[model samples]
Target chain A: MLKPDLLIVGAGPAGMSAAVVAARAGLSVMVVDEQPTPGGQIWRGIEANAGTARGRALGAPYLSGLATVRAFRESGAVYWPSTRVWQIEPTLRTYVTGPDGTLMIQPSAILIATGAQERPAPFRGWTLPGVMTVGAAQILLKAPGTVPAAPVWIAGCGPLALLYAHQLVRLGGAVAGFLDTRMPAPLAGAARLAAGAVLRSGRELAKGAYWYADLHRRAGRYVRGVVDLQALGTDRVEGVRYRTADGRVEEVETSLLLIHEGVVPELHTARSLGCQTRWHAGQAAYVPVLNEWGESSVPGILVAGDAAGIGGAEAAIQRGRLAALRILSRLGRLPAGQEGAEAACRKALARALAPRAFLDRIFMPRENVFLPDDDTIVCRCEELRVRDLRGALSCSVGANQLKAFTRAGMGPCQGRQCAYTVASLIANVEARPMGDVEPFRVRPPLKPVRLCDVASLAEEAAPP
Target chain B: MFRLLEQGRSGEDAVTIDLDGQPVRARAGETVASVLMREAEAWCRATPVSQARRAPYCMMGVCFDCLMLVEGEGLLRACQTYVRDGMKIRRQIGARHVVPSC
Candidate 1:
């Protein structure tokens, strides 16, 4: 059981940044990631796939991770790649299953930068074979250079969806149509926020504008103000049907349907560790409550990156550096006075996060996406539909009790895919704040662990 | 079904694996779901109750729809598992094992 001063859970932009900063400051750091590489989903396979034509087609934001990853590799941090952290105890003991076997480590401080996940927006026929998330499509392209067969249709509203469409077109993949669900109503503060973004982070604004312009020019069948969207198929997706704001229903033929409604913090690991979270209205998700320096309600356990909230990769990196500096200061490793540096970091983080409110306003997912029809399957693991959940809701408002009755969130995923949708539906039906609906209590083995592996743990235990 | 862009591919070593008793070729670093999709095998597993077909929807391991039976491994996620030489895999039919009476 080798212990380190700081144990970082992810090797994304945030975790990698923290490792580099802390290790450079003479603090021992250990970073663990499930992927074989350091880059989280955003920069996945960056080392192996970055130089390819498809990678270049992904644009500047995707390529920007190369320098961060290179710095982390040279920081002399102990990186455990292809490792899965199954449980985190309050005593700072983290249990992980890696290439060797099950092992545990005790770190003085823990930082969870596990990152974000695409929000689960269930709709009719979503379980069909050819239906997948836009993030998933991006993953295939980023990792393996694979593209869905021709006649692919993308749906939903978010920057990621548009980015994926732009990348796909750049890669010579055909997009049959794109259904944008953003309502046309003007956002109250969008203009002011956009201006602030341009003033503060001109490079990011310009990059985003470039992507938007490229997508607009390449994608021909782009429709806005879409509603009542549904994938049409029995065994596999064959087409998509949606109603436009102009009050006309249209169906487009397609073999693959990619959907996205933005992303939310992946909260199972944070919640399982008993970190207090607050419902964020802007992102419509529950974000872990963290102080200015990224420390959670529970001392010694910090959260950064999109896991802390919906901040993008750049903000994640800034937040990670800030957390590392605070840890160093708390450990008496910092010099007598470096307030200026600390203040500069804080200001940079603020600038990085300045544009999020405007983006959230523009890309907010429509209410109907989460509020599925009675027949639409809400829980993919248990195959529980909205009607089944509504039946459970009639008897109780608590998500845990509803789980007991209908087994909505009790499957292998442990509510990762359906918890948000279930919680939102319960809150809407019970006429209570979304926060009032309690999240499912996540237990050990956060990831699916084989029974054999668990049983063999005793043989590989480190001697005291 | 999907295919990789010729110029974007890594040119990784190719390996052959058994898929439902048939030999299928896959790249060394490619996932089982990627190989399946390349071969036009859309349905990965079937639902327990109705035996309805399902495929890899998330492809990032969140969706359990891509569950498949690996030789000696019982059941594993096709999207999560990388392809290996001589690997034996089969489409997971409706519930293969039932819970015994308590």
Candidate 2:
């Protein structure tokens, strides 16, 4: 068993930044992440690849993460790499499993920086091989410096989609085409957000503009307002079909199909800890309710980074620092009113999050995404189709009830991939507000734990 | 279906791992899912419910779509598991056969 003043349950931008701040302030900090290295999905494998040719090609945004990773390594915080924090009890006793086996830790405070997962974009033949999320492809490129040999046809629309397309081109990978599924936002609403973004987040806006221009310059076919997207294949994705903006359905041959519709805060860890959350209509996801200090509804528990909302890495780092300052003050590590960095962190965080509203409005998921066709597999883990869920919707009122009736979310994934879609379907059928359809009730053993691991913990606790 | 970029092929040591009783070469630091993606048969598992073939969706841990039987031990997420020298990997079909707890 281990005891630390604070236990952070991820090693991403937020977790690493938080560990650095808290440890420097004389609070014993420990970060446990499931990756082999400290860089979470944002920097993925920065330590090994940061100064290499691959890093230079990955561009500035990724290279900027090297400094943070270096600071975290030198910060005296204990980092347990390749460790999974499967459960956190209300008592603040945390259980984690790793290469060494299972262990328990009791921490004074817990910070969940688990971050975000791509919004599940289910469509026909999505389960086939060679079809994956754009984020997955980026991870592959970062860690292993690999790319699909076949030209990739990217679908859906978001900043990540364009950024990845540009990165793929930069890495000498060919893009078969880009099928943009974004619908034009109302000019008034979009303009209002754009004005704020330009005023506060001009740098981020400039970067997106660069990627957009580079992608258009390099991509062969750029199809906008794409609808009814589907991958075509028997064993693996061999082609894709989608209706173009001009109302013509086009089919293109491509072995790889990448999709993205932005990311939503990962909710299992927060939900399991019984934190309160509400649906964010703008991002179209459930985000945990948190104060400016990053403290959640539950005292002694804080959430930072994309796990709280869809703020990207820069904002996540700022939030992590802000959370650490609050934790430090709460624990008396810092004398009262000496927290001078809080103001700077808040300003940087606001600026980092400025572009989000405009991006969210412009890249919001199209209406068709929520209404996956009857034949589409809503639950990839349970292999449940939309029709199967619809059959159970009549007898169910919400996501939890639908799960009990159809077992749509009862597989190894525990509903990470399907919860949003299932809840959306239930909301549409039940004619209830999206917020009324609560997500699945997350249980303990957040990650699948081996029975032997649990038994080992029990034996260790026995009187010797 | 996937190939290592220029930097991936240089400097990194290569190791061979067995995939479904066949030998395949892989980079040392690359994950089992990355190695499997380069193989012709990319699907690593058949769903327990429908027995339909599935491959790695999210290269991260959240999506358990990359489950594979390694060394006949149990089903492990290939995306999370790194490729090692002579790691015996097999496509996990249907429900995982539970190994007895000792």
Candidate 3:
């Protein structure tokens, strides 16, 4: 058993930020990350130590990850790279797989800074190899700086979808079209998004207006509504069938289809700890219920970042540090000043996430988050379609039940993309709350690496 | 949070803002965010994630809309660090995807 003063579960901005702060304050800190490097998914550090230009160019601002890596090395922070942490106990203990094998770890305090997973909305022929989430696409670029240039169509809602499209266009990838998952008129729900827009800095508003104007100017329209993805080639995507809001369907040929619809925090660990949770209507998922200090209702345990809710990395980083300060204070590692520090962090958290919160609510999944078309495939692996899912819904079955019937959410991506669509469709069809549908437990590798690579960690279950 | 000048706070070395294409003199005690916001490039990064008109929604790096392609670096969290002289800070709207995933 390895013991430390602080055991950080992720090495992303949140976990690393927490580790840096706490370690600087003189506590022994240990950070275990599944990836070979410390930056996690948002800031994937290049391994070969080559410092390739690939990461520098595409990753943009996160390139400064080198500095953070340097800091960790200097601080003597115990960073177990390539360590897949499978189980996080309620007592804030953890079991992880290191290079040699699985190991149990006990810490004085633990920070659950595990981040979020992108939501997957289904379309026809989406099961094809070339069709992947924007997150997955970004990872490809991050790891080896590889951007597939074969006519990509980025589809779905939220910032990520646009971000991917914008990047793809710049990187010589021919973007057949940029599809915003929301309706063009945006429905009445757009008012909420406009409200969120009100708080944005003037520059951003100007940029947005410019983009909108540019879209109207160039394409004579903005991209909106659902699209039917198809494999134009043998193994990859060849084109897409775009259906506008009024319901005009157009076939567009493409080599790749990058889809993303915001994201939800990875909540399995929180659930495993038996933490009280509430459904965030905006995020369309259940998140650990945390307090102002980022503390879970479960006394010693604290939560931060997307795990608490789908706040971005900046919010997660701040919350992680603040949570640490509070936990340290509570554990008697630090002096009084707990109240003041917590107050400050809370203020920062609110201000940082406020703008996004508004947008999140506006872009919140609707009753038809996945009004899957009649022939749209619901399960990518099994190639199950809406008809199959409808049968399950008619029977009043849930994601798990449907999985048993159709294997919709049990594929390699672990239903990361299909689960929500399935649950939402089920909920909408059944006229039940999303909470009733419940979330499927997430087991490791939270990220699906090669089976051979994950051999060591495979022994440890994520403890659903 | 403090990536832009108006949003920057005093006494904290949060961001490094370049002045007229030249890096300003920022000490460790002051936050790079504060100093960068004071510089001409106050509109450090764009906000797609945070929905902020300006970037650095969390000022901590979680809300990554404030990402900038700095000189000698690809992207850095402007709100998280203090300013440094001669530092090349470039704004990153988005970057071109390179290479292919194996």
Q: Which candidate leads the pack in lDDT?
A: 2
DockQ of 2: 0.79
Which docking class does model 3 fall in? incorrect
- How much DockQ does model 3 earn? 0.02
Task: Give per-residue CA lDDT, model 3, range B8-100, as digits (tens).
Answer: 247543334564466465644333443443343344543332222232222322333345555543454454343554566665543423322
Query: Which residue pairs collide, candidate 2?
Result: none
Candidate 2: list runs displaced more than 4 Å.
A335-337, B7-11
Predicted complex 1: DockQ: 0.54
- Report iRMS (Å) of candidate 2: 1.3
Candidate 1 residue A249 C-alpha distance from true site, Å: 1.1
lDDT value for candidate 3?
A: 0.61
Candidate 3, A1-464: lDDT as tens digits: 57788888878877887787678777888988756567767776444323654554444445656666666667667988757666666666676756666667888777887788766566665555345567766654453334554445667777665555554444445455666666343556666666665765344445545544444343323576664334344434557767666778777776556677677787656666667777677666768888877788776777777777887766887798797797677767875444576677777776667667555765565444567677776655445678878876787776777787777766544665566678777778889887777666555544333333335445454554
Q: Candidates ranked by lDDT, best first? A: 2, 1, 3
Residue A415 CA error for candidate 1 (Å)? 0.6
Candidate with the greatest TM-score versus the true structure = 2
Ranking by DockQ: 2, 1, 3
Reference-based TM-score, model 2: 0.97
Interface RMSD of 1: 3.1
Each model's C-alpha lDDT? 0.84, 0.88, 0.61
Error of 2 at A132 (Å): 0.5
lDDT per residue for candidate 1 within A1-464, as digits (tens), equals: 76899999999999999998899888999999988788899998898867877679987788999999999999999999878888889898988878777787899999999999889999988988888899988888987788877857888888898788888888889777778888764755777877777787787667678867776677768887898788898878888889987898988888788899999998888899889988898888889999988999888999999999999998999999889988998888865556676787778789889778878877878888779999999988889999989987886668888888888888777898899889888888888898777888888878877766676667657465
